[model samples]
Target chain A: MNPTAIRLSPLDNVAVCCRPIEAGERILVEERELVIDVAVPIGHKVAFVDLKKGDKVRKYGMPIGSVTVDAPAGSWVHLHNMKSDYLPAHMRDAAGDQA
Target chain B: MMSGWLRSDGRKGIRNAIVVVYLVECAHHVARRIVDAAADPRVQLIGFPGCYPNDYALGMMKALTTHPNVGGVVLLSLGCESFNREALAANAQQNDRPVETVVIQEAGGTRKAIEAGIAAVARVRNLVDEQAVRVPLNISELVIGTICGGSDGTSGITGNPAVGRAFDTLIDAGAICIFEETGEMIGCEGHMAERAATPQIAEALVASVHKAERYYRAMGYGSFSPGNAEGGLTSQEEKSAGAYAKSGSRPIDGVILPAERAPGPGLYLLDVVPPGDPKFGFPNIVDNAEIGELIACGAHINLFVTGRGSVVGSAISPVVKICANPETFRRMEGDMDIDAGRILEGRATLDEVGKEIVALIEAVAQGQATRSEELGHQEFVLTYKSSAPSGPSCMPNAA
Candidate 1:
């Protein structure tokens, strides 16, 4: 058996799915038992709790990006939801023009 | 922890490598034949492709020949290539290492050059092995390089930051650390400059990044890359932050480690983008180009952090692979040395990974082969370009 999954930072609200998670799999997270739905590829992220729209996804206690859409516990948290906190290209150019 | 092989100039090398560099694209085949004939892992192939006279390429080549990691060098020339082969050979010889040149035309042909190169590599390898003097090395004497590849979402949060933590530890210990790829460094210039040792250096640092931005902008690709977007990075700045974490919060010491010139100590930024304009071409076409740049600046080892799973190192130095994605580590454990990804799954902390990297560095310094080293991933590449000399304030005004 592949022992327990490894959690990154204390602030990380997600555990990297070390092993591929198949649908309906019951994975242990701290004390919670979150069942998986779709197959999460290895090295991808899985939520530790039910996250809502606009909820900031905290990994390493820093805001990596915000969860774009709602995500249920054990659901996958990836590009479909997470977005960067840094400014986009247009804003960056605007900021550049100010100087 | 243990004794390391001593080089003549008071520097130490973990492994004594005889580098066989192709002076031009035409000579690459002959050089490879030579390395293959020698069949020794310690003998590696490196080269530039363009037949143009590029100051950047020439300077970098000279720097790499005298890198602390190299014990000897052999230059292969097609004789007519614009590269300055005689100067390269002279530089290697000046380093007190045995150096020789094999001009394909002068040496008769490919078959002759191959035989000659093989003999040269074998001879150089034997001499280098005997030149090993046991010397005491400290963490402070270590020159380390950091690079990130195959990055994904977890890279910034786990792997990259873990490297940053390790960089912090190494820098605090007085080790010389380097991080590069300004194209990858696009958006975070201001923040990165803020971390420099001095405000003056910060401004120069910002200018250096702007140089890269201009170069890449001319090339029509954000240094961010398509793979980065596939991995959840939206813009260049976001990717830069994750990549920047490998510095571990150390005060930036200087910018663009001059080819062949070692920094006094502390963290450095290898300004890889052309110093002036993007005249040559792709700013470091592949990851190995960056690795080559670090070697030119005297890196004895590289702390390579990967989240999307990269199975790579370098020829002259051992690459300590830190896997940031727990899942990626699980998928590619054999290729990684440290699993900073454990932080994401709540199995390990950043401190643990940092310590592991240090121990790995000491072990590698004592001749323990890294995963990439054992796999024999000795890749090298150099191309053409030019750069105006960095203005003062690029680094702290030298005391």
Candidate 2:
């Protein structure tokens, strides 16, 4: 992650990828270096730490959504593993297509 | 500083526009013909198609008719619509803007009404051109609004923040700025409330987002669209993170419902969703409805940020399109005013693009046509929605 991923706020546990990150790329978060487990496109979020099911995903230091399944650090965090706590995000309907 | 046309209400406008409104869908063709036949760039068309009277639509039409930018308004009625055309015409007249109405049934037929409307438009155009005072305009007099349509992930990173930067600059210099779409700003209410200038305003801001959330939830859908996901947005909250960037880092001044003018200068948030139960089908059916609300709130010019790209301009005010995606901007060269995608490519920095946008606004205020305007993209739409009238607390300064 060196600086390719934008850390919006220090309190956030996730960072938005400023540039696309390939699988196995190194990502730096909170002084810890982690390898991205999968390719994440620009603007998509990447986990800064190991996320448990029901953990709140933070970006810009605010809770964007909640994780639905446990995910390791640096994994692409999107519709597959996360769901909005406010309303059902439309991407859930076409989850299979996202892959 | 640029010159603006002075209105009777002491507010100056960047353009002296003559708006032609059709009371119902039946008179749409005649209204369009009148505007087209006038063959003048200053004459623009806007209307409500639903014959069933909606208080929201009437208020919006009244606001537009007397909007600072509008020099006059022509109401095209088909004689048998539920719309109250008299109230709109009276509002225009009360505001001292030339007002006229042509009822198709009363004018004998479509052809005669068109002739009457054309004549009316010409008379108003001449009267406005002759009477409008050219006054020195400064940044303080500006009321700028920003909105995003066809947003992708890149929008939050590029165009949105660029507009944010520009909004910050304008607010720093004492100009009024507004950002809207509460439905899109969900999940950030806590953070946004922190920026409110007053504690009461902060509470109001949070309530507004909650209102949008409740309304959309009842509709069985979030504001997230299929196009949004296709363009790299995964969820409503994710899109909101980007959409909220357009507000920059200014203190929230106050809130205003649709068709209510901003009380004074500084940064204001427009709550587009209705207050009570979801009476209206949707808050806003499309982007243009939101734009219409912005215009009704007296925005002199709108900065429309688009990642997927939208080619739309308002009737009363010029819309400056800022393209967020460099790839999309490349594909549609002439439709956008600012290429914010340059931020992504590193060809331009955020500050550079922001300054460019501010400069373009000044240039446009001095009477330069935006790309959408030059290309004839006058897309206007007004849908039904109701909100309780704003209280004195909503406009802190005016109160």
Candidate 3:
């Protein structure tokens, strides 16, 4: 019930992992009970539901990135399973803002 | 608990400055020497590093030299560059502020120029200190700018959003908030346009971003910096969304540039892409260029959101770093102003950090020099660039 951990928007498929969710720390999100599947680091995201590798990573009610690999419900969503949906052809470059 | 320094234009100033400026790269050393000799926090060094004629640069220089926050100005000129020294002086003169100039070639050399500059700064500092007095001010009259540099994946989710919260708060209080770097706005036109308060203004907002995308596309380069990828950013649009978050949720009022001021309060976007051609080399080759635009827009202070980390500040405006990444923040805490990552760490709430920013804004406007200011980070840079006025579709509110 702490205010620090918040769901930015209802449509977002993930919640910012504000605090380190322990192996058994139960949390309530949008009336849905999500049991911790793995340790989600702070500033990272936790899966709102079961997701496949190609499913989109939703935040702010929009697809911010997409799952690079498969992720499970209550799993930590990050680089391994998500990549930017905008510029996909190239790696990070200073002037490569047009993805 | 908030107070400000009143300027002649009726706007309040957050700083009372005696800016010693170099008209060209050739005179930069002299300007630096003078500022060093003066050795006062209020006496700051800032200058253009370019020698060629640049309209944007000139307009920006003039705007900054006479910013409400500045009380006096001293020009260090090499005397041969087409920097329009007289015009800059004349503009400062119109404000009835103390302005003196020393031409290194005519002042015998850099040594004499520095000496003259030092004395001028000393005199101006005395005058500025005497002239400055706290005036009751409100949030509505404030002009704030938001910029991003050294960004990573977290920038958008944390630092940028945190600034967004603060911006929303400031705008609610009637402050004029500005966010810039059109080049970064690529792939974000739809979102930005949707946020425009009016349909007409929304179209204009879309057009400005479109223009920027076209300009960069012509250059055969994308706005996504490679450093961005290493920092966890994967796409240009993702980078843009993060960059866009700095605008807050306020409806787009209009678009302005480095040398312009917002006509009124609300959120204004600054189009930083050069109007046309790659002739200007790089629209804004570095972060300073964006800061330059914000200063020219009459921004008294800046909210710089960073994910990787940035240390550069400005000559006319004080930049407050909003650290978005915890690792980045840990490595560069000294350079940072706020740690937005605290939200991620469960140590603070978005609104809590937002309030902290609001409180810091008050403190800075009340004459607290930012960390950048304390470190003597008075960086100024300008280059040649051309911009066709935005099509009528842009800035529909600016009749």
Candidate 4:
């Protein structure tokens, strides 16, 4: 069977879950097999190596953002622990304009 | 090759629809009612909602009215709006596109204006129909644009790459291909610059992305969204990288502003982000506005990639929706023309899907209605934005 997670590039620190991965499920990353410690939903990111706070998170071979807290290998990397490192993201205001 | 309608300027059109444009917000209802009353698929509705005049809006309206797909035009004005209705009608007439104007205030009221509009549409439609001439059109004469909406993690991996492959094929066939949303491409400027055809174009590409970065930053925003993160995209640059894949691997031929036509035929990048600061609120308030800009630049059709599925079609041009998520395709099969998400399931390869899309484009151009077109999704929108004319460096090989 193909791996449940897909790694986009050799430089990427995280892999995208092609299918929902359960806690303790085994997956392969660059010929190295690792066990997940958390349930990573489909299309979410799973860190392949432990990363500290403010470390750049690489995906598709480039830095997508930075983590806000120290995250261990096999853990979920998402909005809860990472944020955009470029310009501040524009959220919908009370008027609900995309601006 | 397909038989098509030949326009006065030696350009071939895939469709011969009559466009009805409302010059201002006040006249929108009357124009829409007129289109509804005509009940003809050859008639479409498009308009601008501003009461104030903007050069970009005026130029875009002119470009759309005379687009190869349009056989004629019917302009609706509210009588006191700042938009110059007479100039628009004159331009359409100058291009030999039969045009008629109806002013609501001058025509008495809304009811009377609608009555006049319906009658005028019938006359215009008959004129264009009588003028139609069947001519042979090849893929080289086609200008195709692409945009990704409701993007998710699956979009970059499946839909975008499939589109990239299609773009490469189309470019090899000598067709003009364009991809926009510079704001979404902020983080990938360095990567895109290397693929530019000329050193000047490479500089322009980098500068344009930097301009977008500055503009979005001033608005205290990046183009990233909560849904994007939910769908496995973590940062603005990540989404940019995914969006950048639609350009394929071809060297970018030129950089054109929103309303400017392509300089000859090759792959081009459209700078949709307005120059200067965030004066017009957002660069593109939504995806449809970007589609509007694409149509203005003379695209006969648009290939829209959506993981979350957008059901929008343009007023003057048809939109072919490609679904990126396999599960989403299963749920919304009726809305999409191509199911690119199958690549993820091992059901198809990327090249297979790319060929399917190219064949579908020829079929669609030869009068096969897209699912969105059949569903009557004529969503048209244009807002205020500023732009300086493209420099000589932006367009290579000028007279």
Best prediction by DockQ: 4
Question: Which should have the higher TM-score, number 1 or number 3?
Answer: 3
Q: Considering only N, C-alpha and C atoms within 3 Å, which residue pairs clash in candidate 2?
A: A1-A26, A1-A27
> Candidate 4, residues B1-399: lDDT per residue as tens digits?
687789988888899989999999999999999999989877999999999899999999999999999999999999999999889998999899999999999999999999999999999999998999989999999999999998888888889999999999999999999999999898899988999898888888999999999988887667776567667777788789889999999999888888789978899999988887788888888889999899889899999999877788888788999998887898999999999988877688899999999999999999999999899988988999987888787876642
Clash number for each model: 16, 2, 19, 0
lDDT of 1 by residue, A19-59 (tens): 56787889887768888867876656678888888987765
Across A1-99, the per-residue lDDT of candidate 4 in tens digits comes to 555788889898888877778999888877768788788776678888898899999988988889998888888888777878776543336126742
lDDT of 1: 0.77
lDDT of 2: 0.87
DockQ of each: 0.14, 0.39, 0.24, 0.60
**Candidate 1 local lDDT, B7-79, one digit each (tens):** 6678877777889999888999999888887877988888888887888788888888777778888889999
B1-399 in candidate 2: lDDT tens per residue? Answer: 699988888989998889999999999999999999988888898988898989889999988888888999899999999999998899899999988899999999999999999999989888887887999999889999999998987898899999999999999988989999999989889888899888888888998899899999998777887667767676789889889999999899999988888777889999999878889788999888999999899899999999888888878889999999877899997999999987776688899999999999999999999999899888899977876888666666543
Which segments of model 3 are wrong by more than 4 Å?
Answer: A1-59, A64-99, B390-393, B396-399
Fill in the DockQ of model 3: 0.24
lDDT of each: 0.77, 0.87, 0.78, 0.88
TM value for model 3? 0.85
Best by TM-score: 4
For candidate 1, give fnat to 2 decimals: 0.12
**Model 1 CA deviation exceeding 4 Å by range:** A1-99, B258-262
- TM-score order, best first, reads 4, 2, 3, 1
**lDDT-best of 1 and 3:** 3
Is 2 or 4 the stronger prediction by DockQ? 4
> What CA RMSD would you report for each candidate?
5.6, 3.0, 4.1, 1.9
